[model samples]
Target: MARSSTEAEYRGMAHAREIANNPVQHDRTKHVEVDRHVIKEKLDVKLVDIPLVKIQEQLADVLTQAVSASRFQDSLDKLGSGDIYAPT
Candidate 1:
């Protein structure tokens, strides 16, 4: 079975970090293409480390945003405004 997306992301970030540190083309790394766009985008925007937020924290943030948006829409529905709010 293939690795999960989250595992792949973690591996990609680790690979990117290793490539950033070494950067030299070698037999082991020659086949691996680091996503330059991701690195450049991060650097251009001055983002430092890729934050390793806890799963609960991430879930909380996502759920909170989702629920808050849903509540607003529910309120609008109750008020018969027919406004639609998409969950974040």
Candidate 2:
């Protein structure tokens, strides 16, 4: 289910996604404002869908974060995999 988010939250997601997807950065700080509108347009047109995933429930954390043994196993299970390299 898609969760409701505040305008600031949406904009923040849009801004972060823009930065991550694009390699080039503007020299001037003022150009940073345009990133929000560009991403907002993509959302408005259904070009992109940003679903909220809670930090604890994020599957990517298995690889990116220092999760506990149980949490790592949980994430791997969610991805339909076994704890092949789980801490012994």
Candidate 3:
């Protein structure tokens, strides 16, 4: 799950730090298991980057919940889904 809040992101970083510092526990993290280490590994190796996406530009909003018409349209446009329907 992608973190949408700053607090959540901070917690994730803290967890990542713990994983890096503790070799034994890193493999046995309760919340962040071995599978989740791929992301941290990528970050450690600088292979991937986390871009700051604004809430308005979050494409998942369109599928996850109800939103204002304008916000819905914004997400749809950002995700390039506008071609699905003819313009009025």
Candidate 4:
């Protein structure tokens, strides 16, 4: 049931066109400007199909190491810090 790359790209273009035509929130004006530029630049670009892989299969060890290192650093930084401990 998966769509071909060309079909998916067509759908993505249609969705982008819809968003470009309808500017929603005031804060989105800047984003819409960027999207407009991107759309114009990519108007004639061909779609390339990139193979997809499961997250666990692709990034299991790498992500695990990154998350573990981040958590370790965060825990180290949180230990024992207070103005009350200053010499008075």
Which model is ahead, 1 or 3, in terms of TM-score?
3
How far off is residue 85 in model 3, in Å? Answer: 6.0
Per-candidate TM-score against the hidden true structure? 0.27, 0.43, 0.48, 0.31
By lDDT, highest first, what's the ranking?
3, 2, 1, 4
- Candidate order by TM-score, decreasing, is 3, 2, 4, 1
lDDT string, candidate 4, 2-88, tens digits: 145456668867776777677573346567678867776666473433468754343333323444655544544455333566698
The sequence of per-residue lDDT tens digits that candidate 1 reaches over residues 11-87 is 87886787757756344565444565668688788895677875434433332344466565555555566535655
Across 1-88, the per-residue lDDT of candidate 3 in tens digits comes to 4434565578879878988789788667755555578889998899999999877777886775668998988877777776646877
* Candidate with the greatest TM-score versus the true structure: 3
Off by over 4 Å in 2: 1-40, 46-48, 83-88
lDDT for predicted candidate 2 compared with the true structure: 0.73
Q: Top lDDT: which candidate number?
A: 3
- Residue pairs clashing in model 4 are none
**Each model's lDDT:** 0.57, 0.73, 0.76, 0.54
Clashing pairs in 3: none
